[model samples]
Target: MSEDFKKRITVAQADYTKSFIQNVFLQRTIFFLVFLILWQILSSLGIYPKFLLPSPIEVLETMFFGFIESDYLFAILESFRRVLLGYILAVFVGIFCGLAIARYKILDNTIGASLTALQSIPSVAWVPLALLWFGISEAAVLFIVVLEAFIPSALGVRTGVHTIPKEIIRAAQALGARSIDLYIRVIFPSIIPQLISSLRLSWAFAWRALIAGELFVNGVGIGQKLELGRSLADMSQVMSMIIIIAILGYVTDDLFFRTIEKKVQKIWGFNK
Candidate 1:
């Protein structure tokens, strides 16, 4: 193919990709708007009770005025604070456990397998134990969040280390790199991408766990509001909380994980 033809093909491909992305965003916006319109129309028809199917407008209105009068903002902040604490704890514990399993054969044979098995258990399964051990308090919620976040993190680090070429380690050792220096100069950097990927997974797990954990907490929280809404058969309040949870999850994912992922991709030459 001619050089000019090749250049034209590349430019055309890029333009098409950009246009496709724009169209996708537009399509999603249209879909959401149409869905809301249909929901409003059906709910306003009065065939079904409002409690069973609230109009989108009612849900939005409740979310606005209801939250201002209630402690909705406080609930959101409390959940966020708990998640942050659990995330930090998970990162530290996961790193240590992962390194121990990866570096030592005996620990890998026992604890590593156990952790892998534990990962299969749902985060909610731990709730009973957490509540029994700590009661319906912050500790139970924190424990559940840590349990959810740490497993993926440990596994991710182990995979990253194991997947590294043996020759790279040998070459680094030959250069007199040993112990902490070897990790700092060679191994640690190589595992950063995997570590960051796990952190994203950890955040997702933590977020889900937080909501579930909050259900057990007796105090103020979004999860508590969810339960209250259910008891009162307040569908608008329930939907509003669900929407808030989704928005918060999306915002955090974008703010922390996606930002890190983009930067890492750029540095790793995966992006132009």
Candidate 2:
């Protein structure tokens, strides 16, 4: 093909790709708006009692005014604080356990099997034990969050370690890399993509655990607000809290974890 024709084809393909992406985004936006309109119409028609199912506008209003008039802002900050602290601790513990389990076959067979089983149990299942041990304190909440998050993180690291090419390890060893050097320079870097995925999973687990813990334990948190709304039969407040939680989860995953994953994948040549 002539250079001019080739260039034209390339430009056409680019335009088509861009248009397709825009169309998809537009469709999604339209679908969401339509859903909200339908919800509003149903609420207005009184198909469901307002107490049971508040309109989107009501929920939005509650969410907006909540930060100003109520303790919603403090609740959000409190939840974030707990989750962040728990997630940070979980990452460190998980990585350490993962490295240990990966390095030792005996520990892998024993602890790894146990972790697999433990992971199947719901995070809330541990809440009772946490309550018994820590007695409705922040420690109880942190304990649940750490346990929920660390298992996935540890498992992810183990899988990542196992996936690493033996040749790379051998090369590092031959180059006088040992112990901490091997981990810092070779193992850790090699498993970054998997680590990012693990961290994302851990964050999700931690968030859920934090909420569950807060629901049971006495605290000023989003979960507490949700419980209070339920107690008061305030559907608007409940919906607002639910929406806020969903938004926070989506925002964190999209803005932080996914962004980091993409960049890491690109660096590792896993993305084109």
Candidate 3:
């Protein structure tokens, strides 16, 4: 609409482009390829025994071959299902707990400190208790995952709610907004950005916790396969499974969570 406004928009676009160029896909690909090359070189020279440290190519071959032998697809699907179930439960519960803590200062001051302290405890630490309660089952894995996923999300939502401008809340109240309407119409919308930011963190925690629990449970999951690989001294299978887990984590985070976050931020006019 104006010359200065047009210049500002152009500058913002250029800055975003520059920042995007400095990070993201190409850099990740380069690093992955370099690591693979180094791995191959070291393996070929026998710096480490092939049984102990299979090359990237060997790992890839084993993964591909496994697919040919049978539908490894089910393993992928099952792993995904467990992670999703635990993560979704955490999201719902976290929102409620976060609202309670953030809306009440006394609760926030007391439980908030405890939640922060709990976060410092690694998710794996809960496995013993979880196993004692649920006994080497999906329930145990889910319990660990929920513990990992819920805490950061709850903290994020609380922080986001607290950070909303006090003037905005007062103005909405002055406009005769009721408490429920105030939260739904004003406060919730304001905190969506921070909530979205925490989803990425929550998913990562869920992933790691899922793997840890699965490893302990020794059931029909990829983590169990990893344990089997270790027991059989099948380094290739172990490496292949690790690669699969990494790829799955990256794809889900990048394609789903990150894409949703970008869209949410853009719609909220917070970022581009």
Candidate 4:
């Protein structure tokens, strides 16, 4: 390619990346606007009873007033605490277990397959066992969240390790790198992308698991609020809880995970 043409191409690519980020922000705003309009219209049209399918206004009121009266803040905080505790535990265990399986064929063959199979089982499926083992306590909820979050994290790490270039490992070994040094300096650093991906996936898993546990245990959370709304036939509260959850999930994923992914992709020269 001509130097002038290459220079133009580089400038175009930079412009495109900036435009893409702007577009994503615009799209998110547009999406929320569209949803709000549709919700308002549908509720006004009385597709369902107002109480059964509350309007956005009613839902917002429930979120601001009804939830406060119900001590929703404490519930949300408790749920967040449980989810974070379980997620952190899952990350630590998954990393250690993944490294072990990646380093040893025997461990991989004996345990990796079982772990893979277990992933197919929905986290909610373990609720009964968790309740039986730990009773309807925070431990049961943590157990369920851990079960959900651990599998994807472990798989992500294992796959990341497996995808590491053999040449890099060999070169590190030649440089007198022991197992710890090899992983720390070569293998682990090489999989930052996958680790971030795992963190995102783990958050989703744990969130779902937390809701499941709340449903079963009927504890303090948005999930418990959902159950309470259902019992009282209060659709506005239900909708409000759902909206808050969607907002929270989107904000976390976009602000943290997607942001990281973009930077990493750019650094890896894969963001074009």
Candidate 5:
């Protein structure tokens, strides 16, 4: 093809791609708007009591006023703090355990097997044990969060390690790479994409565990606020907290973990 013709084709393809993306976004926005309108109409028609099924506008208002007039802001901050601390600890523990399990046959047969079984348990199932061990304190919540988050992370890392090309390890060994050096230079870099995915999964688990813990533990937290709303028969407040939680989860995944995952995949040539 001529240079001019090739350039036109390239531009046309780029424009088409951009238009497709924009259209998808626009369709989503329209769908969301339609959903909200239907929700409002149903609530207005009294299909359910206002206190039981608050409209979107009422929820939005509650979210606004709750932040301004209530302890919602403090609750959110407390929840975020607990989740962050727990998630960080889980990442460290998970990575260490994962590496050990992957490296040692004994650990692989023991702890790795145990983790696989433990992963089947729901985060909330650990709440009673946590309460007994820590007496409904922050420690109890952190414990649950860490336990819930670490399992998937450790498993993901173990799987990643197993999937690593044996040739790379042999190449590194031939180059005089030792234990720590091999891990730092070869193993870790090779597992970046998997690590990122594991971290994201762990964060989600941590988030759920944190909320479950907070619902039972004593403290200011989003989960506590949600419980409070339920107790007080305030549907608007409950919906508001739900929306806030959803927004935080979505933003965190999209902006941080997803962004990092994409970059790492590109760097590792897993994506183009």
Candidate 6:
């Protein structure tokens, strides 16, 4: 390679490193620790009742001791299971519905018109109907979680598919690619980046829906634990549960999608 070309590559690498540092959440770690330190100081000074706003130390202790002494670990695992199951089902159904709407012009416009209105309804609004239809069981919880995630994903896929450049479609069609084959060879690949982005949004929706479901449904999970803390007026447990939920959400997204997202960006010659 030429010397100038090598210099360009080094510049690009430096730019990418700078972007990564700005975009990643690692920088917020110390900021949160500082916040915790301030919280502990206030708690020590008795600015508020411990039961109402427990200290950070108390919250950590509650998480450690509660899990060791009780079924908290199982509760967390069950919660993760429920969220994953609901999210998977949502993705499947969403992809089907999205593709159908995108395929048929009449349905495309019709559903597109109503999609926003339908999705705008909060996930929690379905909880009552879910209970009525499925009773006080896991189904009720699952329904709300699925409903929450499905809307965004379906919309995402349809939008992604629709947004493909017309020239690309025409060229693929000219090459004898038609219908399913066209989609497999051209459309699907083009939409993958968008699909990944949408799935991340879907996870956010599913997380919110899961908490709402667990609060009403008879289940052993974070929502149930939150309720238990409320009944006993245990602020430490409540705080700990909140932190655990936040941690899990962050961890799961990083574990499952971060690698793929970065790879896609790299492939697209975006920030990497």
Q: Which candidate is the best by lDDT?
A: 2
List candidate 6 segments past 4 Å from native.
1-26, 269-272
TM per candidate: 0.88, 0.91, 0.87, 0.86, 0.91, 0.87
Model 2 lDDT tens row, 1-272: 99999999999999998897789768789999999999999999998899998999999999889988988999999999999999999999999999889989999999988999989989899999999999989999999999999998999999999999999999999999998999999999999999999999999999999999999878799999999999999999999999999989999998899999999999998995
In candidate 1, what are the lDDT values of residues 1-272, reduced to their tens digit? 99999999999999998897789768789989999999999999998998999999999999998778978898888878889999999988998888889999899999999988988888889989999999989999999999989988998888889987899899999999999999889988878888888889888998888889988778888888898899899999899999999998888787878899889978966664
Model 6 pairs in collision: none
Relative to the true structure, how large is the alpha-carbon lDDT of every model? 0.89, 0.94, 0.88, 0.86, 0.92, 0.88
Q: How close is candidate 4 to the true structure, as a TM-score?
A: 0.86
Residue 266, candidate 6: alpha-carbon lDDT: 77
- Model 2 scores a C-alpha lDDT of 0.94
User: Which window of ten consecutive residues has the lowest lDDT sum in model 5?
Assistant: 20-29
**Candidate 3 segments whose C-alpha is farther than 4 A from its true place:** 1-27
Question: Alpha-carbon error at 24 in model 3, in Å?
Answer: 5.7
Model 1: which ten-residue window has the lowest total lDDT?
A: 263-272
Give lDDT tens digits, candidate 4, residues 142-256.
9999988988888889998999888988988999998778778989988778888898998999998988888777568878888888899989888877877887788888887
lDDT by residue for model 5 over 1-272, one digit each (tens)? 99999999999999998897789778789999999999999999998988998889989999999989988888999899999999999999999999999999999999999998899899999999999999979999999999999988899899999999999999999999989999999998888799899999999999999989999877799999888988999989888988899999999998889999999998889996
| Model 3 local distance difference test score | 0.88
Error at 179, model 2, angstroms: 2.4
lDDT: which is higher, 5 or 6?
Answer: 5
Q: Model 1 residue 237 lDDT?
A: 88
Candidate 4: worst-modelled 10 consecutive residues by lDDT: 66-75
